[model samples]
Target: MSEEPPRRRTIRDVAKAAGVSISTASNALNGIGRTNPETREKVRRIAEQIGFRPNALARSLLTKRSHSIGIITNDTYGRLTLPMTAGVSEALVDHGVSAFLCATNNDPRLAQLHLEALLDKQVDGIIFTATRADLTPPIDLTRLAIPVVYAFAIGPPTAPTFIPDDAQGARLAVQHLLDRGYRRILHITGLEDYLAAQLRAETYRDLAGAELDVLFGEWTEEWGHEAVRLVMERGGDLPEAIFCGSDEIARGVIDALRDRGLKVPEDVAVVGFDNWRVIATQTRPPLTTIDMELKELGRRAGLAMLDLTRGLPVEPGITRLPCSLVVRRSCGA
Candidate 1:
């Protein structure tokens, strides 16, 4: 009752139709060895008409290049990993290379398993990513035979690692507030253990000195709300502006300020980091924040990995990419 579909066209069919050898057809289609212009055009036209596609496996075997790279991450929430992976994939696709993504869920065994699997598939390189900028996955990345690049992940001291410029991002946030004439600016951020939090706090202190305050706490809306309340209860002059370490914290700060009958950017300006869309855009007046440029970091890492795979020189050690300021209603811009 069922009829089978016609078989797919092969290179041989194109060669037969063009009255040329299969090798000649392949060379013409792939732009390999030189062939006369007329014959090359004829072979390609016939191959196109026959819908003949080269077998990727056979091509790889002939060229000794898989044209595939592996991406390993432990980002269960996909907050950071998703953008980085997108950048890496986009860059690789442009060069006719593909990517394989594997999530380790922060498990060492799972990471090793994924590594082995990718290697078994003969990927040209590997990109290791992390949820936190300063975190290093448990995998021994240096031991791999293939090229490896770290994206938003800490690696060995000598490894090629790419991450956001947290210090510069902090400087940008503080500078923007200063430019807006917000003299009494307060900085509220995540835990002290986080390098990003520390860097932002240090930058704030350097710029504001005794004129402002830096509050370190959890990276949560609750912490932001409580910090505002605590500052108010102290009975000193309220900050004319607040720079939050994250959009989530900024949201809480904005809500708490609203509760106290303060209008954002009129009575007090606010700025947040991580221009995370959901939290940043949904804030009362929207948030002016620092964009970490995670996607760009990923793209650069992908390109770097490709370079390494091609035996090109890539500088080792950490590479810090710049962040940008995203102005919005919250900052009166």
Candidate 2:
């Protein structure tokens, strides 16, 4: 007996069952062009009954739209990029798009390699996060005919981007402290080379408009502890409030301050950023901070990148999202 042709239910099979033309069945399945509503419904019902799944590979070969995007991040699994990438992935799912994730580890060679791989995968677009915006990635991505967007950080000049309003977040934190009747406030933040840290520092200085003392270091808890030590070593001139760049740093500040016989909110107030649960809730007294809305940042970036891929006019510049101060026991706000 002749072997039955491999039982692949094609669009023709669906159209035959639904009593519709092949083109009409295609239109209904792909949601392309226009088709009669009743006929479309009938075609879909018939297609479902026959277990007809559209061949995405064949469809992509025809239309050249892979319905996928690549996300290249500085870190792989944890850190700030995790939430942001998750948000972007969530948004992509809503839009019927897939995400291909790649970790660059903030290395130029690796980032370039990953970029090439994503390009080869024919991703509709790309979203890249880098360690330093000014580091000048050497990836020559101009050959790829796809849109690229940056999220939570800026990439090369050839892409549109979105980043949290760090300066605004800092301003919100400092303003809250000042409004709470705290004059001697200390700023504990990351290195000045980082754009986010620099912006926060500048905004604090601008808002304070005075010779304010700032303690700058990396984003680690060690820096936070060191800031407190420096303050204690300087004697009774300790600030009435401390503004930290991240929740990790804030946790360190809390430990150091408590160990040195100072009462939070009673002797000094503290404010942090990122609004992470581990640092905000896990501490002895819950920490107050500015919520940067990381997930929303990723979602917006995904939408913007899709727009770019469609040859639609995207606002070719930085898009800033709103941030807010989350009041907790830390700042006594």
| Top candidate, metric TM-score | 1
Off by over 4 Å in 2: 1-13, 45-51, 131-135, 156-158
What's the lDDT for all of these models?
0.89, 0.82
List candidate 1 segments past 4 Å from native.
1-4, 16-20, 28-50
**Candidate 2 TM-score versus the reference:** 0.90
RMSD of each candidate? 2.3, 3.2
**Looking at candidate 1, what is the lDDT of residue 200?**
83
Tens digits of lDDT, candidate 2, 1-333 = 898877989999999998888999998877676888888888889898999988989777766788899988776555667778788887778666889888877677998888888878889998876544444444655456778787876655556778888888999999999998888888899887888888888898887655557778988888888888887887777788889998989989998988888888888899999899877998768999999888888889888877877789887777779888899998774
Query: For candidate 1, which ten residues in a row score worst on lDDT?
Result: 207-216
Task: Note the residue pairs that clash in candidate 1.
Answer: none
- How many clashes (backbone N, Cα, C below 3 Å) per candidate? 0, 0
lDDT of 1 by residue, 1-333 (tens): 899998999988998999989889888876678888899999978877878877889878876889899999998788888999889987888677899999999899999999999999999999999877787686888888888899988778767899998999999999999998888999999988888898888888998776766888988999989989998998889888999999989999999999999999899999999999988988989999999998999999998988998899999989999999999999899
